[model samples]
Target: MLLLLPTLIGLVVAASIPPSIPHETLEVIPDGWKLHSTAEDSQTIALQISILHHHTDYLDIAHDVSNPESANYGNYLGAEELEASLPEYQRSAAEVVSWLNNHAISKTTLDGDWLHFETTVGQAKELLGADFMYYQHGSDDPVLRTRKYDIPIHLRDAIDFIYPTTHFMRPKWPAKMHLLPRQHIPTGPVTCATSICPKNLTAKYNITHVPADSNSGSQLGIGGFLEQYPDHKVVQQFLKDYGLRHHDKPYKYKVTLINGGKDPNIPAKSGAEALLDVEYGMAIADSLPVTYFSTGGRPARTPSQPGNKVVPRNESGNEPWIAFLQHILKMKSPPQVLSLSYTDDELDVPLPYARKVCSLCAQLAARGVSVIVASGDGGSAGTTTKDCKGPNGKLRFIPTFPASCPWVTTVGATNDYGVAHYSSGGFSNYFARPKWQDKAVSGYRTLLNGSHMAWYNKTGRAYPDVALAGSGYLTAGGGATYQQKGTSASTPVFAAMVALLNDKRLRAGKPVLGFLNPLLYKNEGMFRDVTEGDTDGCEVGSEVEVGFGASKGWDAASGLGEPDFAKLLKVLT
Candidate 1:
């Protein structure tokens, strides 16, 4: 009877006799969420159900093609080719749909591997045997979720995991910026020591190659979330004010909206993160077509009273990462290079949800897309360490997710001199160390020699694969110029450089660089090693001034080192 049941979501379970329905727990709510009260039975709720794939060989296949040393290097797959490889996609969807239909969930929209449906709170609770309750975090609006959810043992094989059930992570954009008095834009070479701009990045990294025309099949993508619309008019003004040229082409960029994402043309309503990303990315990768992916996450709340101010809503949708990646993966020819500046604490995200996001990244890698992410803004602990303590009341350092996912290339921050103190870097608490980084991480591991054993996971995946200038950036946003700092600046800077390299590769009849970790680890000499500065925070209990320090090799502070564009292009192309 036990052998008849299959393994599901990394859990082993046994089927019960026909008289009883064997309920298997799927995912449990993460820590730091306070249960307020039971949700209203009549309240409507939306859920996304992840279906299990019959074959997952694409994970390894993604690695093989991404590795420069492999014979299948750059041999990528398309959206249809990759989906067809999953043998049981249709069968699994059929089973899951039938199960949902049996529960009276007839209205569902199936998109690839995800099945989306809306149901009443009462029906959701009765359908999945879950206790739906309102959980709140600090002063944030309370969200309706369950402590844990279970499914009938028979349907375990058809489902991977249900999202927004046990996951409580809300993505945070980590760029810190301040508005400055309007000043004259310099026409000559901008001083690199004072601020980071197009001239500074191009000259410092030896980035001399011109990006081909937009029709050359080379494009860069920036992720816009939480209504972060990139104002095109602002970017156009930035190009003109800075005296920047777009390879003799007009300054333009495209936007793709997902899940009702907004794209307001008003500069005052623009998000600083989105503006900085587009402004600098276009400036650096001049002439390359840029696509801003505005993904919707939280919906605007309706006023409880007609004349009252807008109050926060208690309901939330899927994580923006899920919606953004799902949209990109479905495209026939997605952008060759993508930069995302949003992140969440690893512990705040459930293990299954994190893994699901990682798998989506892997699929993008298989399709020959560079998935670049910010390591985070807070060093070790994340954003700020004020009253920082693990949910278990333990003095442990918190790691960042997606950055810790191992599948994507995570970049940290550096300054004019060395590693930025706030550049987030650390080992993952969820994923294990990957083989590609074994040699690189060993050098830093030996430097520690069993120190900070109680702080973070020793055998976990480490991040900030590489670091670049992130501080003191003169960014244009919201009809004003500002000085911004954070890994948010570093992420797009690095991504633009990669997009330029992709342009070179595309001209030479080669595929775009995808999954850069393996290639970067293999060629450590392409970066300038930085052995200065240390990460901030993680001061727990009486352990004052606790954090990882920069070392000779790839310590968390600045992984490998800052990019040397000349060396990278010389070796890669």
Candidate 2:
């Protein structure tokens, strides 16, 4: 699922940059705080973390998760696609650290107390030499059955620590236009998207709606799909069942469990995963001071958006959403963070909408709103879709759209180690790296018992303007707890961080992070550089395709390791 929406706005003069990190700021982790960790064998490693900015007051922790029922479920689709061949044998993630102490791939020293992995066989064994395990991707599930890699012993030998990246910040949800739930959608947030006439660039566009769904969102008939298809694996396992659901938004989703039916082949109804993205991305949107927008998801059934925001193309060439944006911009101030998580990856990247979408985002960024877009999930990023179908008859080299649109702050996915494997990061046949790629803002995975490599020193070029964790482990969704993985999980986590930073900047009275590219590019050490592992969609076994990974300065794969958001605030503030 991708995020897509439209808009514009006007506002007061950009706020002034805040004063030199308030007295309290400079006083805490004075200037550069040097920290070090030691390996079991007694080797000391240095880690430089500049205490850029720290704020615990309004730590707007907005990321995604949960249904209206679950506790603190924001928008992380909880269900993870398990490494179907995960190494059953378990080992303390700490043991894996001991092995890395002897043989390490990255500059970051390993500490068993934190988290670590030890590869026991295959490529990792061959590369790092026995005792480590490699994690592979979901689609690569079939390869594990073979002795392709000795993954179990290494998995058992490792002890790992993973902190939940997102949590409900609080009950305060943010949005430009509030919405009155129509039928299926719960009543809470609102979108003033009336079927009024278009007013902006959208004024030139036109679309139609299914007659049965004249009010696709206002009526229950159109929303019945939610109830009827709870059994559908994609929905049950990923959307309704996944992530941390808050108590307020529970009705937004009904966790009724479904069956594949007595017959294993029974098919269900029409549906999509845009909401999962909305919830996740929404958290990010809320976190930031910027206004979030999307084209609703996919090519929203004609005029309705994925989030069901209505589009009145006939009206001023813009829909209510766009108009609302303009109205907000006309106010005393406009939002600084704008996010669109929808994409038409199956559609052409240069389509009229793609151009419009990217152009709009570019317009916002120019005005100071840092636009964030998901690089994409479909491996090819829309370079190969349409006629390109796989053995399963599904689009084979299908590309994710919009992310290919260079104007927005595009982000790709990465694993815990900052590797660009999974279906996340990659170059777009349709777009080029934007200036942002060189700057701040932007944003893979494992397996080998069905385990494997993510980002390794320039092993591949698929990026993530930055990186965050998007691999396996655990989550809760549908009606039960399960596991899942994908770039889908990474986007929101990044959004939340953006939100936290935005809050800090706003409180300090800074020009809301406009075009973050320049600032991010100006600073380097603020981030912990990622420098290992290789993304496999492009090919790995072939020695000819090596040297792709993260490294000193900027390399693809993992743009920059997970951000030290607080430190980043100090630099920017």
Give the TM-score of each candidate: 0.90, 0.41
Q: Write the per-residue lDDT of candidate 2 for residues 276-362, one digit (tens) a residue.
A: 333343323221222222221111111211232342222211112222223322323344544444343423222322333444444
In the order shown, the candidates' Cα RMSDs to the true structure are: 5.9, 28.8
Per-residue lDDT of 1-573 in model 1, one digit per residue for the tens?
A: 667445552253222211224333423344545776566788777888888776788887898899898999999999888786554676888877887787789988888888888888899887777887777666555666776677766667778888767667767888888666775544443533567777778888888775455667888999998777778777787777653563355678999888767788797888889988998888888888899998876622223323433433323455678888988988999998999998878877777778889999999999999998998888877753533466565667778878898888999998867899888889988899999899989889899898877888888999889998988888776545688999999999899889988888888899889888899999999999989888886664566645678889888889999999999989988
Best by TM-score: 1
Where does model 2 exceed 4 Å of error?
1-334, 344-347, 351-353, 380-400, 426-463, 473-477, 538-548
Q: Number of clashes in every candidate structure?
A: 0, 122
lDDT of 1 at 541: 57
lDDT of prediction 2 = 0.33
